[model samples]
Every structure is written in C-alpha cells, then in structure tokens.
Target: MEESTINSSILGTKEYWENLYQQEINNYLDHSDPGEIWFGKGLTMKMVKWIKSKSSQLLPDDGDQIKILDLGCGNGHLLYSLYQQGYTDLTGLDYADKSIKLVNQMASDLGIVNNLKTYVADVLTLYKSNLIPERIKFNLIIDKGTFDAICLNPDLDLNQVKSDYLATLEAILFKGRSFFMIASCNWTKDELINMFTKSSQSFLSLYDEIETPQFSFGGSKGNNVTCLIFQRLS
Candidate 1:
C-alpha cells in the first residue's frame, strides 16, 4: 500500500485534535452544546439507521449479542444515537483524552454511561496495546472519517498506518463473522475500495454499500460522502 492521494494537514496531528476537543469541552460546559458532529447530525442518524437495518439481517436473533466498536468516536454522538435506537453494547475509542472526556460527560448527562464505554487510544498503536482489553471482540466496527484523518498525518507513513488499521481491525473483530463499515468525505469510492481490498494481507470482501446523495460538477458526478461495508473472510 502506498500513500493516499489526500494531502497532509494539521487535522492529522493528535495535538490538533486535543485542542479542538478541549474547545468543544469548554463550549459544552458553558453552553450545553454537544460539540462537533463530524460530517453532520443527519449523517449520524443515517449511520444509526443503516446499522440497525444491517444488524437485523446479520444478527437476527439477539441485538444485545452484537457488540459494536466506533473507531475514533468523536464526542461519541454516533454511539449515543445508536443507544437511542436500542443498541446497548457499544464501545468508542479516540486518541484525544478531551474527546473521551467530552463523550463521557455526554453519556453521563443522558444517564446511559453504562451503555457505552469510551477510551483514549490511538488507532495507529491499537494492536497489542493495553488500552482496550484483549478478550473483547466486536461484531461490528465502524469508522467515520478516522482513516481520512489518519492519511493526513505528514509524520507517519500512510501506507503503514493503513496496514496498522487493518491489522487492528483483524485483532478486534470476530473473524468471518464481523463487519466493518466506514464513511469518508475525503476519499473516492474506488480509492477506498482499493485501500482495503488491495492490501497485502487482504481478508476483507465487499458486502454492501449505502447510497449517498450525489453532486454534479462540470458534468461529472460524484458523491459528497462514500459509505462502504466489508466483511472479514475466514
């Protein structure tokens, strides 16, 4: 895997994230604002609905048995929305401590603190790290713009980071039975597809995709966001 075409930016640095989340924390305390919602509030609900529909087909029997992990879960809005829809077993991970703190505060405010657990863990260092317990394996894992942020890191090799991400996914997800869904605003559909499928240790297969709104520019059509779902093969 080579570097992503996306240019490096400050958004890739942990320091940038910490400062952003710290400001969000201040705003949350002062004005009761829940902070940034990533792409938008609507996208959060859209992801929640998509997960609900897929879990029905995949789990079928007991929704509680399906454990889900949100990679780079900023402010934990997605997990919070999922909890509202009756998905209880959820875990969220973010590298910034302020991000985790804000999420914990939000969860505590809603009195659903026990429903979703959050931690401060960097995705690039997730494998073999003690941040998340080793025994826990998720049935469904999701990412909303995390990989895009990672690819923006000018310090680390994007290819190595992508590999580390996939390796982390392999470690935490149930083999052959788990699903990974990602929504990205930066990468094209084809670029994202090749990133996962063309890896040297590829074990993921395209399961399905969600249709997002499209925009036309200069007579060329493109999506504002791309949502792809993949399953780990045995």
Candidate 2:
C-alpha cells in the first residue's frame, strides 16, 4: 500500500473509528465464521517475557499489584498475556472501535473480562475534557505497533504528531514508571534515542535501551527493532 493511502486511512477524527466499528459489526453479521488473527506465538512469547522481566524489577514488594496501560492495545493480546501472568489491574486504549470489540470478546472468552478495561479514544484526545480519570497513572505503558502505525501515515505532520504523542505520554505516566515502546522503522538508533531524550527530558529519564531481534516481512531482518524502556521521573 502507498504511504499516502495508509496515512489517509487513519487520519480522521473520532468519526473514523466509529464508522469502522459499524462496518466491522455489519461484516460479522454477514459472515458465518470469522477467525481471529493473533500476534504470532514467537512474538507473543517475547512480549510476555519482556513484561514479566519488567514487572519483576518494578514490583519488588509483594502484594503490590501493578497497573499497566497498553497504548494501542490491538485486540488486547498483550493485555491477555499480562493477565495470564497475574497482572489484574490492566487497561487497554485503542482508537479502533472494532479492535475494542474484538478485545472485549477475547477477554470474555478467556474469562478475563473483569480484569481488563477497554477505551476507544484517540490517543491525542484522551486527556481532553478529563476523559481519562486523574487517578489512572499506569506503572508501565507498552506500545507495540502503535508508533509504527502513526509514523507510517503520510498525512501526518511528523513534528506536530510527535509533540502531541510526547505530551500525552507525559500526562499519563506516573513518576518513576516506565514506557516500553517496540517499533520497526527505518530511522536510525541514534535518531530515535535523540528523539526520545529530547521529548521526555522534562518528565522521563532514559534508563535502558535493549536491542532485541525482531522479525520483518519478506524474511528480512532488522536489528534493534528498539525496545526502549524509559523511566518516568519528574
């Protein structure tokens, strides 16, 4: 797909996702069997490990339940992994309405509906009008493919979008917390590092940068698919 097309596809305001959900719902009604697409087993296991490792380090005190917010939590697959790992306090934020529906359905199927919260709102607009409660500061926020999707759009004004994303991230994170961002992009490591450092200087401290192997399409390979774990410190 052309970059312009991909960008235009998701550039709309709230109405975009609402219409998307309606279409998905109609399609579901028309189809007899609809199968789910999963984040592959290898990828899921890697994420699970990452979550577990981070949670273990952060949650040193026993009986302290950690709150996690999965930004762009498509279908809640990562949330499901965290749920299986015994993290009960979880919330998923996704702009796609169909994704929220599918996530809720999956949660119900897995009997974890009670432990997860789903929100359908633009990431940039989440805090406007106090849409997200003040008491909801997450211990960790995980971004898998959300950043890639945002950057992949050709219609996006890159600098403006980055500024908005950074501001929103700072608003939501608690002091000394972390954001684990996994991305696959053509940008160099130094560029990404500089971007994060510049954007998060006021609210976050760069703690660790992990270079992990990530699979790419067409049997290609990429290094440092960059899992950045930034500690929120104001």
TM-score for each prediction?
0.94, 0.76
The 10-residue segment with the lowest total lDDT in model 1: 56-65
Itemize residue pairs with steric clashes in candidate 1.
none
lDDT of 1 by residue, 1-234 (tens): 565577899999999999999999999999999887888877777778888787765572344468999999988888888898888888999999999999999899999988888888988789868778887888889999999898899998877888899889888887767789999999988888898887788788888888888999999999999999998896
Tens-digit per-residue lDDT, 74-129, candidate 2: 65667877788888989998888877886777677679888999888777656554
Judging by lDDT against the true structure, name the best candidate: 1
Please give the lDDT score for candidate 2: 0.66
**Lowest summed lDDT window (length 10), candidate 2:** 1-10
lDDT (Cα atoms) of all candidates against the true structure? 0.86, 0.66
Scored by TM-score, the top model is 1
* Angstrom error at residue 52, model 2: 1.4
